[model samples]
Target chain A: MRSGSPVYRRGAALALLVVVLIALPSVVPAFFINFVMTQTLMLGLAAATIVFLAKYGGMVSLAQFLLFGVAGFMYGNAALEAGSRGLNLGWHPWAAVAFALAVTTAAAFLLGALASRTTGLYYLMLTLVYAVIGYFVFAQITEISGPSGITSIKRPELLAAPVSLYYTALGLSVLAYLGFRALGRTAFGLALQGMRDDPVRMASLGFNVPLHRTLAFTLGGFVAGLGGLVNVWWNGQIDPASIGIGPTLILLIIAVIGGVSYFEGAWLGAFVYVAMSTYLRDLPLIDRIGITEARFNTVIGAIVLLIMVLSPQGLAGIADRLRRRPTRPRRPAAGSADETEAAIRRAQLIDE
Target chain B: MTATRRRLPVLAAAAVAAAAAVWVLFLATDTPAGTVLDEPGAFVVTALDAVTFAGLLFVAASGFTLIFGLMRTVNMAHGSLFLLAAYVAVGVQQAMVGKTRNIDASEVGIADWLVPMLAGATAAAVVGTVIQQVFLQWNEGQELRQALITLAITVVLADQMLREFGGLAQRMVWPGAVTHFITIFGQRYATTRLFMLGVAVVIGVLLWLWLNRTRLGMVVRAGVDDRQMVRGLGINIRLVFAVVFFAGAFLAGVGGVLGASFAGAAPGTDGAWLLNSLVVVIIGGLGSIKGAAAGSLLYGTVVAFSPAYLPSQYSFYAIILTFGLLALVLAVRPYGLYGRPA
Candidate 1:
């Protein structure tokens, strides 16, 4: 019950955050809420899938974005009228959403089963190849996606209003954040972390390492699918460009910049990314430096490089360090040293 | 049991090869309806085309594999380096001729080709060295982090190249000597492609000699096998890494120049080349020069021949076939044909 307890402080901060998010539409301009905030939440949720794999499962997959795109494409294909381009089974909106999620989850499960055979850099490359292959397939499949991709899929009435959509995105984000946090403490989560540390040891302990990894990846895919569902609703379209290399890498950049070690970092990274992409072109300094709207990627690249060099753990890591600094004097130096040693060991294990 | 397990992959590989041969023979004959090949000469020409394209792929992928083998860094920016060189070569040729108009291949001399090749290779080597020293040097052994950093570099370099060189595709003016078609096996083939094939062969031979016949090559080999042991032997591993990076980037630059003369270079060429390099290295085995060659040949053949042989209705599936080859290879041999388990 102590006011100074870390749990109490965290709880209070989370409450304030919830209240602010709930009231954000009233305070902010409609454009900000609709364009920026909603996009941030959706992208954040997508990035959260990446964070979950990287942080807990020790797998940095480039295919999460592909899954997101798949979900969006599936929904668009299933819900849109047959008159529109691409396959349109003309299912109900809710059915389409469910179908999209289920397909995405299954795809992720299959991808994980295939990719889990390898670890570290091999896994990364395999997933990247998957994304690239997915992109090419989507681009060429005119029967399913058409040349330009499916478009004009109307949002369900429940989410037609901008405010409702915004709140839905926000609610989903919160649910995902809490879900990941809680999952991280579960037996399955602990086993995944164990596999991340030492698959051999986990295997000897009777854990089916590949199955655990695949299950985790499937969970991540479902979250990404949720994000994709909102994304299509917000944008009212799905195209090849949505899952192109640029967007694929951008999602990874978001996950890394936010801090892959923490769930909240996904949202934090997404907010920064959305803000910079939306406003960097308008900045006087950017204009002076000759960075046009098209060259915003350069700015983002520079920022990501800076983040990697200066704070490898990302903005969240930097925040954590700053928050812990004031309390460091009271804690034993051995504790910090031990933490660093553990981190080093974890990195080495991952490299193996 | 262990011996049986060890023999399994070889058996699988042989089976795959046999299946591929059967498929090729099936395509070569008139058994399939609407076959593109009316004569055996056409098939020979297509096969030659596939091999030449593979030559370009090997040139591009060799450096990537070399870099990956030594430093364990994926070097995603490798494709950007290729595109950069292509653009630079094009610029140099454009500037030297002092004309924006398309220069005929016959009008250009040795210097026209030589100068751009030198300039492009030099530029790419310098950039590669800078990347290794400035960005990658501080973060050694952290392969994933290094990969992300290179990815960032790719974004910046790709954007900058787009800014400097317009989005339109451009190609180099080939030297007059290699512009004509040469008769091979009673079929006309582009001499430029034959020249490319020759270049790839020469480069491969030189690389083989460098790796086997020289002390530096031995060090590189040892470093690839066990970097820590090499370092512990009092070798300056960082310098070796830098040299490998330079050579690898130089090879990519050469590939760019050669590729520009053949397929041309464009905005999205970086991603395409990157994908090609990835597939080649993955199939051939990462960090193995021989694997790259084998993988490139397989990949190039599939890409070139599939479209021609596939029915007109399903021609687009050729791309899928190329990727399917990768999937098949991965399923049989996870580390790749020539790759050792990390």
Candidate 2:
């Protein structure tokens, strides 16, 4: 969150967190990290994409999973059909990525074009209805189901190795996060901020507001779709369950828990969620914690409710507050409040 | 303007005829004309059954419409509330006659369906009030969060229900023996269906009367239009909302009992009915008393007859049809059939 501080200026706690993550492979048991890392990465990307919709385009679509589904299917079918047809187009990793992004963005464009016509809750309902429609179609379609969802969708050749695949996903996520940060400060991003602030003023300025709105959706679609693709590859197959309305809601929970304003919040949320699931699944102490594995959802739901009530600004805000808190000084007996005061002054001056 | 208005019925009649012709063509091609299709009474029987189911659907959906329309909130756990009530009613009957399943209908000996109905309604009201107070009241204006939180609750509840109730369809043993089958123009049908239909009619009419003719109804109507203003006037908005939720849930419970009586209660009914109500309320008009009625009848008729007339494999086709209808209605009247345009 305070990436600008560098190692020396970085909060000692964050440094410790980084160290823990780096050494987690050795410290934690193998299976937990494997499961946690995988799930966190998948959901993080999905929820991170949701941040773009909420912060930039001012959309809250419950049916955003439709876009995610489109991405997964595109990759799966491309891989299956191309591999069978002996075409490198499907087998090639980049090619599959391109297809996924393209299809997702295109569908985003179509949906955005329709959705952009309305505002507020109407847009949400339309998006939700469309997503449900898409989910039903995919579930019912003989082509997709085929007894089991995209069966034999073997791990691809390039990112076949789990550890290697993990790194690649992690890398992509970092890149996507950076992309979001950069775009949030750009002119196009500024225009989007304008739409969120006052669409009437933006539209009256002849800014093709609807087109920009559509592009925002397309952007959301691209990120979510990419997440879907990675998840499919990670799981070695895509099941109908992979892209249900329920999972989409879970992604929303992640976004809500992690603070939707900062892009990194998505990663943090995903990480927490996956860890929770893993802990619930494997740990016996979860029962002692008053939640059985069977009752894990209750725990997760409670946590989400608490987060929304307590710190709706999410993990990102917490990160900001921690970063702003004064660091340990060389001089003994210097209180942390002094640093916080200094930081507050700096923020005030910056605002001025 | 007067002449054009007067001719509206003529235009409507012509359109209805055209639509009927199309429906006939679709059914004729889709359904097989065998023993099941024979007996002219079969047509009458099916229509009556459809109407009965439609009435029940209307009762359930009106609750859905009222909540969503007024609050702009989607109660994803609404179906669970419905199913829980049915389960409550079942628990009552099961106490009378041991075992919740596969009992002879004649063996059920209890006085007046009213007692069980009251129990179902009361249970539903308490449960609904609790949910509203606990989860919904805090998240009043937070639409997506409310939907999702309730969804999580629904999932947890559904799993827990399945575990407790055992994944079997349990019958709500009706009071008194359904000793005789009622024949409507020589079409034999269950007495329960007729009774359920009567229940639906009474519920619908009573609700309509309550909403329109009562002071509380007037206040609720005013509150629906502008909640902030109502609160400003020192009205206990929260209490009114509790009442609305209770009434809505109680109605859903009524539908659940009636539905369970005929269709049998099983797992997954919550989701099915929830989705169906979404289509119903959205199509008719969210929050409009009349809209829920119209939407339910329209939806129920299509759902009931579609199976008899169309391919059985496409039971889900009913869902798609509802979706299409929702879109069409929203297109024509973006606020739903009776919703006030923004």
Candidate 3:
């Protein structure tokens, strides 16, 4: 797979992408670079958690936001000022974050243990039930979640500035993406992919389907937790509303819109979702149509419907198709050459 | 182990009740609050209210589970449909009340209530038909895709309802004759609730008879059991599916009207109802009328009694316990009490 100029081309492309992102703040408006990109990257991380499980584990869990919300609440309660909306642990930032991660991991594992026994719609419902329950549980506990929300979360010293925080999100997301890519190449990852395609066959091949799925779910939860931690830091607040059905659906929409099958799709989906949400109302077309801020859901819903019907693979899928289009013409000759090589090797082995 | 597994839900339910009993006992002695147990007369009243509320919740959840059982598609927008129906019912009721100026303002006649109920049911059924035909039919068997599509539909519908109806909460004013309070077990309770309970029972019985005896109901059950086989038998499966969808949606509309008659309808009610029905369906076996009934009773009892017994500060414990019950049920009987494992 790495035998030619394509590897170098890919490396150069990656380098250029990184350079553009780093230089984006200076080139573009601060609002677009900071508000848009920073928020979008954090959201993308959350969506990436969904995409990871959907792509590799074939489990479409609706509880990703639950993990995000749990971690966010933990951070908010521990790190935010005491006597505010929620519990005031007033722990150090690192200590609070460590606690958040631990709680999130345990919650994810427990949820996974319950959910992994089922498949398809049952699994969907199980996770959805968890999400709904999680929302209510968190919302109702006024002492922990507060009546309004936990607010006034101070960012850490090193990543307080919007630009620096953006960089941190980008760097963390890049690391996560690389980690996922590496994971996907390992034996366990290969087994997961195989299980996703045909779980019965994988099981027949001596794989522990439920355990693998649970592990994948745990990893997905961690990814989502990280996203939540960053998101809480970015927003400087955590609310029950942030973890409810609306946000969960938004995350799902973004993941599906960007292309649930690809890692890069999460970023693309988050970009589109953030852009549409933040900028769609100001569009001239909407203004001409007299679309108010209240009616934005109609537009978003219509977009979701259209995208689901016309291009279920989302924007990433479209990009993938475009990229593959140029290479399609040479596919037959390359396939024939490989076929001949395989035939010659087989014949030589038979003769021997 | 298998026998224990089968009995786990019942056991868990019993355990929950016992725990609740113990908590109420503690509250009665330890807590200095206005709990129902403190005033003995309130217990019966609370139980009655819970039963009535559960009756309405059951109507909505039965429809939800029916559609799912037959089609394997969760109607994510069932709550929106419920809310829409409530708005329609209220709209019709207001129109009638406006026309009847000669009559007393508080006294709503039978026509006012009946016509609105029919209107709401029809509107919801029509919407369900359109949804099934326009979007869902094409994506048959793609549960996730269909669910997403329905979610979008719900969002659109919910927004439209908000735009049209505004954000105000409106309750249906029942006929004045039936709205009065009556003594039940030495406690005064709204007669309208008793009427609602009776209506729910009648509807439940009718639904059962229709499913077991009527030709269409039999087809629906058959379709639920095996859609492909029914299709192979030369039955017009599409028509059956559309009909089932309409019936399910129609039930939701009926429940909405009933709900709004007392509880009132508002912007967030759709989400609340959707979650309520989903929880009920989860607790009761999905797709079973009996299961829906059982779930509603338990849910209604918990919701009703919690607010009555718990302190105002800890009222949200009801929601927590409801889902906790759900978790317990899932651990015991994953497919629900009556639901077959697919």
Among the numbered candidates, top TM-score falls to 1
- Local accuracy of candidate 2 as per-residue lDDT tens digits, A1-352: 4456464454465456555665666777666566778667767878877777776666666556778777777677766653321122345556776877898889788777656634444555566567666666566654444225664555567776666555656666766776886787899988976776556566667787668877888888888887777777777666556666557567777887787666778888888888777665677565676566766666776777666555555777676767756764221101121232233234324323
| Clashing pairs in model 2, backbone N/Cα/C closer than 3 A | none
Clashing pairs in model 1, backbone N/Cα/C closer than 3 A:
none
**Alpha-carbon interface RMSD of model 3?**
12.3
Which 10-residue span in candidate 2 chain A carries the lowest summed lDDT?
A329-338
TM-score of each candidate? 0.92, 0.80, 0.90
Full ranking by TM-score: 1, 3, 2
In angstroms, the error of model 3 at A247 is: 1.8
Give model 2's TM-score versus the native structure.
Answer: 0.80
Give me the overall lDDT of model 3.
0.80
Q: Rank the candidates by DockQ, best first.
A: 1, 3, 2
lDDT of each residue in B1-342, candidate 3, tens digit only = 266655776787789778778776555443323444565566678778889989998998998998998987788889999999999988888888885223342668878888999899889988987998999987787776777788888888888998999998888877776777777656777788988887788889988999999999999988888899999999998898898899999999999999898788998788888888887887787777788998899889878876667766667676776766676777766667776553
Model 3: CAPRI class: acceptable
Model 2: per-residue lDDT, tens digit, B297-333? 7777666665555454554454455455554455444
Interface Cα RMSD for candidate 1?
6.5
Candidate 1 residue lDDT tens string, A82-186? 755778789999999888998999998888877765666776788888888888888887766845788898888888788888999999999998899789889
DockQ of each: 0.42, 0.13, 0.27
